[model samples]
Target: MSALLAEDLLNQMIPPLKSTDTTAKAARWLEEFHVGQLPVVTGTHYQGLITENDLADYENPDTQLAELPLRYADTYVQHDQHFFRIMELAIQNRIQLVPVLDEQQEYAGVVTVSDALAAFGPVPGPAGQGSILVLTMEERDYSLSQISRYVEENNAKILSAHVVADEHDPFRIRLTLRLNTDNLARITATLERFGYLVSAQFSGTAAVSEDEQDRFDALLRYLSV
Candidate 1:
């Protein structure tokens, strides 16, 4: 359940410029790269980043790229930052392309809005095609999808999955998967063999034991806790 990092999502080696570069060159880079902004740097150190809106003042378009006031990342992040924070910056600023920097303040890459959306958007959970094995797993474990694929390949169908960060440890996640349970026993065995921390059952005869009374008791306990 290791989530993608901002640096991994960022597009750091973006179109860049030296302070002395001309505005025309900047505009050209913007158009050529099909980007609205370009990060301006000096050597490996980040000097500033500039956008077309910042350049709109210069109708001439011939101004020196160096002369235009360069803007920097208002909420820029280091290269090793979390992806969720990067999403917050893009949504708050209403801009694309989040710049990433190294410890030396040097340009690393850029994280585009598209990448963040792709990574953070609703993704299919385990038991993708058939019945799901809803449970909790250590965040460091990366076999969630693998386990789901195995279930699906064996003729089960995964309905849906919900994942929540563990309250006790952020590094663990509680996953609830809904899967078609035609062969419930086999599915459970497969999941257990694959190292899934099986905590509950949710289908057919096995589900009968977990009726409304049980659900109510569980809810009460949860609320009291």
Candidate 2:
């Protein structure tokens, strides 16, 4: 599946009104859209966003929406930004909607979690863009240290490293490394010298080998199951 773009996910027509808007109107919009948060805009510029929590303190359902506290997002993505990045932003902030802006900072639209989720499919994204390396070693191995040492020694950084027991063989552990480097042969050679057996390397590289594809599939199945 392909990644979604902020522009593709943007709900430009669903812009939220200013704080000066009546609480009743805002509530109605929330109900109509079924969104917990709405992006507020003034003319063509973005002002802030209003969330459902801000409505809690209001005793009157008839209260002025503008009177509700505004919760703003410090990070807003331009319309040109990738949808995957938008999803990350939403998850990090625990918000559902992200306001999209043009290069001129004009309010272009909004990226909602629902739209993004639908576009991108299942997430807490499972082994999508980065590289994955499968290093085979003994159960007594301090896998992380070995991988870190080799990665750093190679002038590339390790984004993440993990160790999982070889399901079919408990005595062996599969050390997975998400790294900055894509050179499989070079990485494998370095680790092999340190007594680590590199089973496979998976990455976002255009040309994925058969073994890499199998490992990628294995990762997805593991994550889902």
Candidate 3:
């Protein structure tokens, strides 16, 4: 697949407003499109993002957007930048729309968080059989090369891997992997043997075995009672 760039995800259909536009018009567009923010530009040069809050703070519908406070004048990503940077900027600034700029620093378009999520929501994996494995470890222990080596030793290939910091513990991270095999028993054993904590595993046979064991334990407790 081709690289997922910011430009590819651009919502060019969402028309940008000029600084000369009235706050009432901007607010009407925000309400109609169900977006919290909109890009304000002068010709091709992006001025900044005008948000609903900005309009509410101004409290004057007749006022021009130029007179109001437009935020993130420098908070835009290039058209060729990876989509991840767009997500980062959206999260950091707590904004819904992220402006995209071309190589010449002219406004290209805007990308919405909803659009980004839709583009990246799919689990990256091969078209064939596979299993998912979730592992939790310290941030310092994350080594993709080492983990790939272990998976390879077990005769399994990793189709895709995603890492995210654990919200409960900032020092730890969660690694989710999709392997190119249905059975994960051997791979799980190998990872555990090497001190990798397999927090969760998704496989047909393993799930059945776990369910049976839980049922057996429950039966034993009932009989004793």
Root-mean-square deviation (CA) per prediction: 12.8, 14.7, 12.8
TM-score of each: 0.52, 0.52, 0.58
- Residue 9, candidate 3: C-alpha displacement in angstroms: 0.8
Show the lowest summed lDDT stretch of 10 residues, model 1: 216-225
Superior by lDDT: candidate 1 or candidate 2: 2
The lDDT values for all models are 0.62, 0.66, 0.76
- Residue-wise C-alpha lDDT for candidate 2, range 1-225, written one tens digit per residue: 232457777776586676567666777798888888888766776777877777666768777655555666466887756554564566557677888888798888888766665654443434454455767778887556656878788777776554555645769766656565545556667888888887766554436777546555544343333
TM-score of model 1 vs. true structure:
0.52
**In candidate 1, what are the lDDT values of residues 1-225, reduced to their tens digit?**
344566657654465677777777887888887778777777766666777887778877667766776766455777656554564565446556777887777777778867655654433432222232456688777465786787777777665555656546779776655565534677777777877777655343344454533442332222122
TM-score of 2: 0.52
| Count of steric clashes across candidates, in order | 19, 4, 0
Q: Candidate 3's residue-wise lDDT over 1-225, tens digit each? A: 334578889986788999999999999999988898899999999999888878888777789998987888999988876555675677567687799999899999998877765664443443334665778799899898999999999898986676766546889877867676767888989889888889866554455676544432332222122
Off by over 4 Å in 3: 123-225
2 or 3, greater by TM-score: 3
* Best-first order by TM-score: 3, 1, 2
Q: Arrange candidates, best lDDT first.
A: 3, 2, 1
